[model samples]
Target chain A: MSEERIWTAALVVIGDEILSGRTQDRNVAQIALWLNLQGIRLAEVRVVADRTEAIVEAVNALRARNDYLFTTGGIGPTHDDITVDAIAEALGVPVIVHPHARAVLTEYYATRGGLTEARLRMARVPDGAALIENKLSGAPGIRHGNIFIMAGVPHIAAMMLDALSGTLEGGKPLASRTMGCWVAESEVADMLGAAERAFEGVQIGSYPFFRDGRTGANFVIRSTDQTLIDACFAQLAAQLAAAGHDVVDGGI
Target chain B: MSEERIWTAALVVIGDEILSGRTQDRNVAQIALWLNLQGIRLAEVRVVADRTEAIVEAVNALRARNDYLFTTGGIGPTHDDITVDAIAEALGVPVIVHPHARAVLTEYYATRGGLTEARLRMARVPDGAALIENKLSGAPGIRHGNIFIMAGVPHIAAMMLDALSGTLEGGKPLASRTMGCWVAESEVADMLGAAERAFEGVQIGSYPFFRDGRTGANFVIRSTDQTLIDACFAQLAAQLAAAGHDVVDGGI
Candidate 1:
């Protein structure tokens, strides 16, 4: 497992609405799942307000640490939409009106209304950036190096991810198996620790929940290697069974 | 507004389930909303894995910049739960079995199961830490020098918050007013910017949504001063109306 290549990405969610609790962030989960499907692990997530300095700080810090950096929100056609400007500043590049983006917005708004000055704001991108196609809206996503600037809207971000599917280089996706038992996690803490330590690359997570006046826990075993994951699960399940606990196959 | 003190808090969400996309975080919004009600601003949020180094790093970094730091998750009774240890290490203190916490857990688990050694893990706390009562769960939250360590479960965290409500010092709660208009956010971008600038201490946020086969945007004016927020909302709403746009009072 130490010899295997592992690719990681970080996400920065930028919006005052989210920080104010006015909006619930769906982008983190959406992006994490998408990155997982692309065989990349989502390592960390930061939620910052609609501030230029904050955006720049998060972008620079994360991009330097991870293989890829993704940002969501503040990519709209409003004064608050300053993500492009901040990212451009972070990269030491100038903001430019991407021609393809302008063309797309012009055509899309031709039927609704002529592309007004405010609407044209959507075309702005960091210099020397490639466009990620957006099937839901006219504003295309910006891609420069390993940094991807995406829309704040959940569906729009999903579309951008769809455009990016299978386009990035990554290692094998993580595989996981969940087993549930109606026992306190603490009861099996020793077994869980020993199994995890025995497996080379496996990491086990225990989630406890109280339902219908009963306490239960779900143990999830994850690893890049499917065989290792399976072996770890088998060992854990056997140990739990030996301790008089019934293992639910697919989790409760 | 500039003369008024601004109380800010940051949150560190600790879990592997969240980073794995297996869990959607509810703590950020819940804590943000609760902080707002307490006249404190939620400045930033970071979601990190269940690693001691990551927890320590996030805790040290955010605790220095903000007035208060709240951490959720990684406090359960399992091997994966190591928040107390990590925080204790970060604070350069040894983990001690808090007498109050031990008594509470002992009594709570007396009927279900005797407080075993593994269950007693929940009683460990950083030295010199005070307990924040958890009404839902017997294991209380940890409070040490402006750092509040809460449960991962949303309801239990809410209970902990309820116990500590109004106990912390804070400035005036921010006031906000929302207005909805049946127009693209880009169409009113300039007007929104101007209205925000015209009113002192007011910041406006524009959120666009597509509904009923039409695009609309909601403008929210926020400020510590209610009068200023109202003024900003009135000016922005009038401007939208003057432009032949329908304005909804309470937002779309």
Candidate 2:
């Protein structure tokens, strides 16, 4: 498993609404879950303000290291949507109006008010970019090199993701299994660490919770190999049961 | 307003669960809201893995640029909880078991299970660090220099934030007003851009939504000055109304 290549990606979430605490971001988790299914690990995520300098810096830094880089938000028709221009600056490319995007928008909005100049702004993309289908909206996502530009809206972003499912080259999907116990994770910290160290190419995460006036925790075992995960989970569960802790199968 | 000093903070969310899509992060929004009340701006946020190298890199880079840095998660008693060691490494300090923290944990677990070695792990902190009280949990948060190390649990982190309220030096709190309208943001993009440019010290962010089978958007006007925010929001709302759009005062 150590010899196997691990594909990784980074995400850049661009919005001031998030920084202002006015909106809770859902893109990071959605993209992460989607990437997990694709067998590409989400390496890191940066939530940056809607500033060109900030966007450019994050994009350049992450794109250099990861196999794929995704940016959500600031791709709309509003003036705050400066993702294309900033990405173009990052890549040292010029911004151009993509003809296919323009045609799509023209047809979609032909009946619903027609594609005005402001609406046509969605047609802009970095030079040498291809389109990612967005079934919900006329404005398509952009793909330039390994970078993907997605919508700020969750449903629209989901539509674009649906259009992109299983299209990218990825390695074996990460396998995981969870076991829950109504015991303080602190009480079992040493055991968890020992189990993790005992299993090569496997990691265990302990998440403690206080619910219904009781302390409990969920132990998640992760590895590329499902057999390893199953074996580790069984050992952990058996240890918890032996320790007189009430164990739950999935989570609390 | 431009002459007034502005305080900024960056948040580093350290968790493999978050990066793996196993958990939805609530700390970013909660801390963002709390910092807003403290008159400090959440300038940037980075979600990194539980790796010490990843945490250290994010901590060093963000803490240098911003007035304060906050890291949530990875503060538990499990072996995966390496935030203290990572930050200590970042600051070139050694980890020490704080006597005060040890006392707290001893009292807390006196009846439950006694402060065993594993439970005493909560007493570990970077040297020369002060403890931030976590009323919900005995494991106090750590505050070293301008960096605040908070708990992975949302409620514990909230308690720590509550303990530190009004303690940090900050500028005037940012003020914002939102107006919603049932119209495509694209239809009013030009007016929004023009309004923002004319507002001088204010910034307007247009967030579009598709709710209740209708297209709508909320325009948020933010500035440190309440008067500026009000003036900008009113002007934009009036402009939107005059353009034949139905406007809602506090967003739809």
Best by DockQ: 2
How would you encode candidate 1's per-residue C-alpha lDDT over B4-39 as one tens digit per residue? Answer: 999999999999999999888899999999999999
RMSD of every prediction: 1.6, 1.3
lDDT of 2 at A31: 94
> In model 2, which regions exceed 4 Å deviation?
A1-3, B1-3
Q: Which consecutive 10 residues in model 1 chain B have the weakest lDDT in total?
A: B230-239
Flag clash pairs in model 1.
Answer: none
DockQ of prediction 1:
0.82
Highest lDDT model number: 2
Clashing pairs in 2: none
| DockQ of predictions, in order shown | 0.82, 0.89
